[model samples]
Target: MTIFEATGAAGEQNIWGIVLPFVLMFAVFYFLLIRPQQKKSKQRTAMLNQIKKGDKITTIGGLHGTVVELTDDTVVIRVNDTTKMTFERSAVNTIVSSAPAVAADK
Candidate 1:
């Protein structure tokens, strides 16, 4: 009788054995994957809202140019003094400085 009762108590205590692993996995995923992704998305949104004419930016396709115009959903980027291309606002990957890079002496 004592042995049987002890086995039943063990089963009850181990009820959480199945659930605890899943809960720990979810917490790990949230911290390692989901939380940083959400933070990056928020920063991207803020950058998009701050876009303005003449800002140098890089696109997701790796094109770098200066912003010439902005619309509700599109931007006109000047690739050169005489050439410009339009892209969706979401295509911008990052902003770059318009200042010319200092050349290194050979």
Candidate 2:
């Protein structure tokens, strides 16, 4: 057998040595990081898509307001009777309330 072919044949026997580490590392990251992030992203997308007028929301930047209008890709939120800000629908982080807040723990 030629020298290159002999070496390659030997190397093939240890292929798992090279590939297993990468596979294991990817598994660790998938469970610890990637999977949870994907879940949160899906939930966030669903929440954003379901937004409607009069729902209280907080933006990713922590601006709290009530949704006054919604469009395909943007939102108009009223911070006060005469104050409003327009933002991308994705800028919203969470819904705070749809009704007045009351403490359930107290």
Candidate 3:
């Protein structure tokens, strides 16, 4: 085959090779980064909404406590005997235990 014809064929292949890598990168980012992040956010929101008094929880800052009072946008958590702290509902990280936790000293 002529050199001109060979060059033309290679040019077309190069364009697709360049584009394919970018497409694959985007797919990887979506599945590995974006999709899992979205799922985690949804789960966190659902957990916050389901919180109730006496449920044991931990804050995003790692403080462990029990839910004492809940409001529209905030929660009152008893961190220890006579130690209560208020935090935004969104600040709760996870439910340490789903069962109602009774203070042993009570």
lDDT of each: 0.91, 0.92, 0.93
User: For residues 28-102, what per-residue lDDT tens digits would candidate 2 score against the true structure?
Assistant: 999999999999999988999888888999999999999989999999999999999999998999999874444
Please provide TM-scores, in order, for all candidate models, with all chains considered together: 0.79, 0.76, 0.72
Order of models, best TM-score first: 1, 2, 3
Off by over 4 Å in 1: 1-9, 98-106
Model with the higher lDDT, candidate 1 or 2: 2
Off by over 4 Å in 2: 1-12, 99-106
lDDT of 1 by residue, 1-84 (tens): 699999998898798887899999999999999999999999999998888887899999999999989998999999998999
**Superposition-based RMSD of candidate 2 using all C-alpha atoms, in angstroms:** 6.5
Better of 2 and 3 by TM-score: 2
Model 1 gets an lDDT of 0.91
Residue 86 displacement (Å), model 3: 0.6
The best candidate by TM-score is: 1
How should the candidates be ordered by lDDT, best one leading?
3, 2, 1
